[model samples]
Target chain A: MPSIDVCYSPELLHLYELEGKAVVAVDILRATSTMVTAFAHGATDIIPVMQLEECRAYAEQGCLTAAERNGIKAEGFDLGNSPFAYMNGQVKDRTVAITTTNGTRAIRMSEAAQEIIVGAFLNLEAVAQHLRELQLDVLVVCAGWKGKFNLEDTLYAGALAERLQGEFEFENDATLASLYLYHAAKDDMVTFLRQSSHVRRLENLEIHKDIEFCLQHDTYNVLPVWKRDRLVNLKEFESLGV
Target chain B: MPSIDVCYSPELLHLYELEGKAVVAVDILRATSTMVTAFAHGATDIIPVMQLEECRAYAEQGCLTAAERNGIKAEGFDLGNSPFAYMNGQVKDRTVAITTTNGTRAIRMSEAAQEIIVGAFLNLEAVAQHLRELQLDVLVVCAGWKGKFNLEDTLYAGALAERLQGEFEFENDATLASLYLYHAAKDDMVTFLRQSSHVRRLENLEIHKDIEFCLQHDTYNVLPVWKRDRLVNLKEFESLGV
Candidate 1:
């Protein structure tokens, strides 16, 4: 049986052995959520870069660019980390290059994994079902705020752990802790997450809608998976009998 | 009002600013518990060193030495990390030097704090009362297992957060998460912690008595605080009227 573990921050990723494991990089407040949303709305692929300049440079190659720093969209970028920006056919049939504070760093750091999947509450069940089929050891990497632990990503990890329970074994305490947290917050996540520091920080920035949208469960049946240089929808890819 | 934050592992301590904070270093699976027990049993002072050689070197200067690695006592040391070793007047009125895998490293890393205090369930409320009096921003550093997060230390952080709820504002999501974990585990810590990887690891090593003893709350009124070079019982120091 495969085991499920959670790395609370990208800073602590060095402590984990990522080889031959599937790494689910989640930043529920917006990054991975945005990636899943983009895939759901017919975006071709996404190149997740770590720097604003790298994201901007992709625009020369006709790829749509998105960048967020400290919860605000970087000036001159076509879109921010908000999922709403990826909607209404804005990114239809287009490639995108993106960067964000925490999410992109986590995905980039997880390059050592056998497979890297972008996970979020939007496609929670889709990711879980896909993992069940893969039967690989899963490590949920929560893209914490500024290299420290954050609540939103951890809750998403817990929800995933709960979904994969029974078939998956938890080898570490983090998975157990996350499952307990998910149980405590599942009934009323909005109220529960209102106490979170990042939620309050996002509220202060007036991105209340993004927070609400990102917390919604199973809104999309997409799986944004890394393939060499970009994230493409794995669920969509599989449905086409590829 | 002063705020409470939790650094889940000493490896992630660099993310926190410790200059003006009072750091409570907790290693509940045994290191901090043993230090509190030694102080409660009338030991004079404890010098927490990082290496076994450093701890062993103190014996030449008439100090008792205790060292543990990977949950087992290092060979030729006078004591292991078990609190039971300090009982029955064994370490009475004697200065001791100690080293362990996680706990002493956490104490040494927290040297930048205004004060560093050793905490465990054995001295839980005593440490809480001391924090309330000091009224400074507190960072509870969980001396996690080998720079990775563990359940026992995190549960201790949650227990401490729950005890200091109203007076101390939580500035981070880690504290809130810990408080919830504590609430979920407080009723039957033994059962709750049985799911923990470290507890299972310790149980495999046959230290059941140490686990049961460390989980008992407020067993001692002692506060083992770091002065310049050693940990001395602050409660005893205050009673001396110095």
Candidate 2:
């Protein structure tokens, strides 16, 4: 079996040998959740851009652009970091360009992997099953806050690591720490994360609904795979334009 | 109230503003436990050196030298990475220059901190109480395996952070995750860590007793504080000749 490891933050991305592994890019707080929500809600595609200007270019091209900095939505964008923005039929058949403080940076940094798939609690089974099918060694990359470690991302990675534990050889200490956490907090995520730094930071911003929604499990049967410069639902992306 | 934070590894030592903060350096699997045991067994002082040659210099001067590389005791050194080596009244009243794979490197890397204190499960309560006395912002630095994250170190940090939770504000996600882990595993640490990578790695190398001994709670009341280039028991280091 291939080995499964975790990169606690994007800053430690260099420590892992990710050349041929599959990278499960995670930002459970919002970015990956929003991306998974967008695809599941029938959004045509999502372009994860690292720079605000790139997202702005997409906005200028008439696509729905979302940018977030320091937990606040970017100015003049159609949507903030809210998952609800992509949840309803609003983004049906549309394209969304998202640039977030941490998630996009993680995606851009983990480009060396064989595949980069978006993951969040919203689509846990989807992402886990996708990785199971690929059967490649997995590296759960937590898009921590500005090169620092955060709880939500690591928890999400832990959930996935727990899901894939038997199939993959757990080779890193990060993997063990996270799997233990997943077992400890699996029963009550929202309550478990109540004391976490990101949740509290967002609470002050008054986004209780977003945080709650992100912690919900298996609401989407979609795995957003980054391919050819955009994130597409793995299931739908495979059949499109054939 | 001092803010409490955790650096998951010494690799992230640069992220913390350590100039005025008190650092609780942790390498729970072996190094700090060995030092605490050395102190509890009446070793006068232990010098932590990063480079093997520096440790060798102390060895040449007739001080006992202990070294470990890649989990095995280093070649021609007095002791490997075991707490038991310091027990049995072997190092009583002697000075030791000790270097290990992770712990000593973390001590040297975090020299910027106002103070560095050795922490392991063996002296968990002692270290926690010492930090409460200082009331300075605390950064629990995990001496991870070569710039990567590890389980035992993070769990020890979490244990201390949980012990001092109310006196300090939790400042980061790493801090929160670790505290939660400590709370969850408080009753049964040995079973919790049985599945971890380092334990398994060391098990194959036939050091199960070392792991079990390291995980014991507050077995040694001695607190090893780094002052003026060496680690000494905080209680007795003050009484030594100037």
Best-matching candidate per DockQ: 1
- Candidate 2, residue B49: the lDDT equals 86
Error of 2 at A15 (Å): 1.4
Q: Going through the candidates in order, what fraction of the true interface contacts does each contain?
A: 0.85, 0.70
lDDT comparing candidate 2 with the true structure = 0.84
Query: What is the C-alpha lDDT profile of model 2 across B58-174, one tens digit per residue?
Result: 976879999988788988888878888877667889999998888998888888899999898888888888988998999889988888987788888888887887899886778
- In the predicted model 1, the residue pairs found to clash are none
DockQ of each: 0.81, 0.62
Question: Looking at candidate 2, what is the lDDT of residue B142?
Answer: 90
| Candidate 1 global CA lDDT score | 0.91
Return the lDDT, model 2, position A91: 81
Q: What is residue A99's positional error in candidate 1, in angstroms?
A: 0.5
Q: Write the per-residue lDDT of candidate 1 for residues B1-242, one digit (tens) a residue.
A: 89999999998999999999999999999999999999888899999999888899999999999999999999999999999888868788899899999999999999999999999998899999999999999999999988888888988998998899889999689999998898999999999999888999999999999999999998888999999999999886221110
State the TM-score of the second chain for every model.
0.96, 0.94
DockQ for candidate 2, please give it: 0.62
